[model samples]
Target: MTRPLLDQARIHPAALAQIGSYHTDLIAEVEAAVAANKVVVVGMGLNPFPAKARKILDGQGTPYKYLSYGNYFSQWRPRLALKLWSGWATFPLIFVNGTLIGGATDLQKLIASGEFVRLLG
Candidate 1:
């Protein structure tokens, strides 16, 4: 399933470079973690959802790498970059084996259905 994005042609050439480089360092950090780890959860501080996701993983004895950014009171710009880059629009972006598996509720469903374990394998 492909998420629709603005056509590059629709964007001005001069702005493309800036858009490509926008907060790329943060995105690269998450990318590197996802590449190296079997499971990765990208989340922010002060958010219970990320913690909940972690707890679920813990319950399953699943070791995962977690990357936390700033909380509600700070660092929204950097977080925005993550949202735009991932197109997930929420915290605790969970990735399993280099594929995004959504957030906590989604994770729980996957686990209950046995797909989560299958994914790890």
Candidate 2:
């Protein structure tokens, strides 16, 4: 059988550094949340930031949701719709604790700064 991602029930050092620099307290908080059986949601698309974020979350065993239309929709289409109606599509929208993070870059910054982990709790 393969070894679990979290061996010895602890996070890997390199991964910890990537995620720990942002929020020193985040690891503890996430551990607590998981122990409590709370749900954490991650919303992202196929963009670079989302892809990176998903990678981190996967290692952490955190759950997330993906939202992307891929190459099927163009930016101007929203404008076209607005001319006909008043609706449009947006990007980098991430919601956690009922707050939106705007995009993957923002999440990367947050994770780097350590805020992402604290919020998981």
Candidate 3:
């Protein structure tokens, strides 16, 4: 049998360090929220992916923590930096129990395949 997703999941040390509190207290708060919550969604601007992810979570009767940072015109750089480091190219970087679940498409795939449910428990 294969190992569980959570069991196989790992955050690279270099990538973890790349996060490095870059957004003052905002990123810190996100980190703290992620630590406290089983499901966490990090996004940029008023992105639709986060909403989509939330809709899925809601449909699944699961509670999730949402954290959005930066915007389109002025402050998107920070979120871009987050993407560069985290290897997620889009909004709604979903995480379950501190494991990266990626963006909206990734979330959808996991949910459709029943992996999301398995990971949750």
lDDT (C-alpha) at residue 88 in model 3: 67
User: lDDT per residue, candidate 1, 68-101, as tens digits?
Assistant: 9999999899999989988898888999999999
Sequence-dependent TM-score of model 1: 0.95
Model 2's number of clashes is 6
Q: What does the lDDT read for residue 93 in candidate 2?
A: 43
Winner by TM-score between candidate 2 and candidate 1: 1
Instruction: State the weakest 10-residue window (summed lDDT) of model 2.
Output: 79-88
What lDDT tens digits, residue by residue, belong to model 3 across residues 65-84? 88878666666877766665
RMSD, every candidate, angstroms = 1.0, 18.5, 7.4
Cα-based lDDT at residue 99, candidate 3? 83
Residue runs of model 2 more than 4 Å from their true location after superposition = 1-46, 72-90
Candidate number with the higher TM-score (1 or 3): 1
lDDT of 2 by residue, 1-121 (tens): 3432345348778876764354434334433443444333322333465566566667767776544333324443332322222111334345556445545566667778888888776
Note the clash tally of each candidate: 0, 6, 0
